[model samples]
Target chain A: MILEPHQIELIGYAAAFLTTFAFVPQAIVSWRTRDLSGVSLGMYSLFTFGVGLWLIYGLIIEKWPLILANAITFALALSILVLKLRYPRK
Target chain B: MILEPHQIELIGYAAAFLTTFAFVPQAIVSWRTRDLSGVSLGMYSLFTFGVGLWLIYGLIIEKWPLILANAITFALALSILVLKLRYPRK
Candidate 1:
């Protein structure tokens, strides 16, 4: 069965929202507690860069789901990365 | 200028790898440290479910990028979730 374009777009949007919003609580807690010892700097660094690339890819393809999701994700990842850097887990 | 399908696929694969692999270090650290106090269970639950949905979406679209990325990401997320449940943060 062929799905409508709008339906496909909706699925993409839903997916984007779920994946992007999932990072919210973690970012908040990390910021509030400033306890990133459990968090990995390498992971956040790679994640941020990756998300940035996804955003670029989205832009190249002109897909709203990819663009919007990666935009928000990139910002969140950056915040986590900044926190990780500020509070080194030595 | 129109790009080849392979080139676009390459971009998708690259994006998927960066985002998916980003979790590797975090998963490893969380597993080794067993200190998830900083990790928000809500976040991981939402994330895992979201990734599962992404996998389903990938399957529906018959896109290898989403399929492979979400599959790997789902496993990693599951590992984190299990750890979160097995060792709750009090």
Candidate 2:
């Protein structure tokens, strides 16, 4: 099926919004509970770094959706990573 | 700075690779430990759904990078979600 440019952009925006904010709940949970035992340190470490790279790539590509999404995601992921480090499994 | 298509593609690939595989460690950890105390159910549910949208978006755009990355990521994220649901915290 053929999609107009605006439709494509909308899909991109939706995808970006979903992926970016999906980390919010995790961040909130980690913050309030101060428990990261079930969280994987390695995953957060790699994921945060990956999100940073995604931000850089977005900038280079000059795509607002990518830039905005990755920027927010990076911050959220970073916070989770910090929480994981701050509270290790007992 | 101006970047050639190849350079831009390379960056996209790298970003895709990192973000996609970032879930591996978490999946492995969850599978082994079966302790999801630190994992947030809301986060996984939202994230898996988001990744599915990403896959659809990638297919519509016909972007190999997005398609490949999101496809693998969806699988990995789904696995983690299943594990999260299967083993909830006490």
Candidate 3:
């Protein structure tokens, strides 16, 4: 059975909002504290690359849900990855 | 245009494997080092819940890409979250 249009949109929106907020706190804290001592650069690099690939997959499929979630996640992961490399908190 | 069957499977597999490996290092390091002094619990909690929701969404839609990536992510995130709470490395 086909889902209602609004229902699909709602799910997409919920996923987008949650995925975005998921990284916001970390982003804010990392930015504010400027501490990368505990963060791992290697893992964040892989994390960022993985999320970027996910975004590419979403784009190829033209799936909005996947696209939105991966896009936001990619950005956040990249931010963390950059901080990890640049700051390298001890 | 529809993607080739193998192509689709390859993308899914790639996404899943990458996402899974993405967290393996962190888990291993966290497990061995037991040093989460740099990890943020509040952010990890949100990240875990968000990935869990994505897994739910994947389950409902029967999307292997989302399911595999999110399942691995949720498991890893949960481990990190638990470690964060239980250990709270300083």
Candidate 4:
């Protein structure tokens, strides 16, 4: 199936939006409850670092979807990572 | 700054590998502990769905990096989500 450039970009944006904002609930939950038992420090640590790299990669490639998504997702993931560190399991 | 196509793709793959595998620790932790206290259902629900969309988008766009990364990430995320549902916070 052939797709116009704009259509393809639109799809990319949609995908980016969903994936990026998906972390919001996680961040909010962690922040409010301060429960880090189920939250994996290793996962968030690596995920945040990876998202940062994705942001850089996006900048290098000049892809707005990649750049915007990773930028926001990085912040959210970092916040969760911080929470995990702050309130480790007792 | 000019980057060769291969170089650009290399960065994408690296980013993909990180973001995709970042879920490994989370899955393992959740699997072993079966604790969903800190794992938000809303987040996983949305994230798994989003990753599924990413997989579809990658297939449509024929982007191998997206396809490979999202496929693995989706599996990992879905597993976590299932674990979350199966073992809700006590």
State what share of the real interface contacts each candidate retains: 0.63, 0.73, 0.44, 0.66
lDDT of 4 by residue, B1-90 (tens): 788989977876777788899999999999999988889999999888888888988998798878988999999999999999899984
lDDT of 3 at A16: 55
Which scores better on TM-score, 2 or 4?
Answer: 2
lDDT by residue (tens digit), candidate 3, B1-90:
788878976775676577667777888777777778778777888778777877877777788877877888889889988887877866
State each model's C-alpha RMSD to the native.
2.8, 2.0, 3.6, 2.3
The CAPRI classification for model 4 reads as medium
**lDDT per residue, candidate 4, A1-74, as tens digits?**
78888887777677777889999999999999998898999999889988888898899978887788888999
TM-score of chain B of 1: 0.83
Ranking by lDDT: 4, 2, 1, 3
Q: How many residue pairs clash in all the candidates, one count each? A: 0, 0, 3, 0
Worst 10 residues of 4 chain B by lDDT: B8-17
Q: Candidate 4 chain B TM? A: 0.86
Interface RMSD of each: 1.5, 1.1, 2.4, 1.3
**Model 4 alpha-carbon drift over 4 Å, by segment:** A1-9, B1-8
Q: Candidate 1 on B1-90: residue-level lDDT in tens? A: 777878876777777788899889989988998987777787899899889888878888899877988899999989988988987763
Off by over 4 Å in 3: A1-13, B1-5, B62-68
Please identify which of the two predictions, 1 or 2, would achieve the higher TM-score against the true structure: 2
- Candidate 1, DockQ score (0 to 1): 0.65
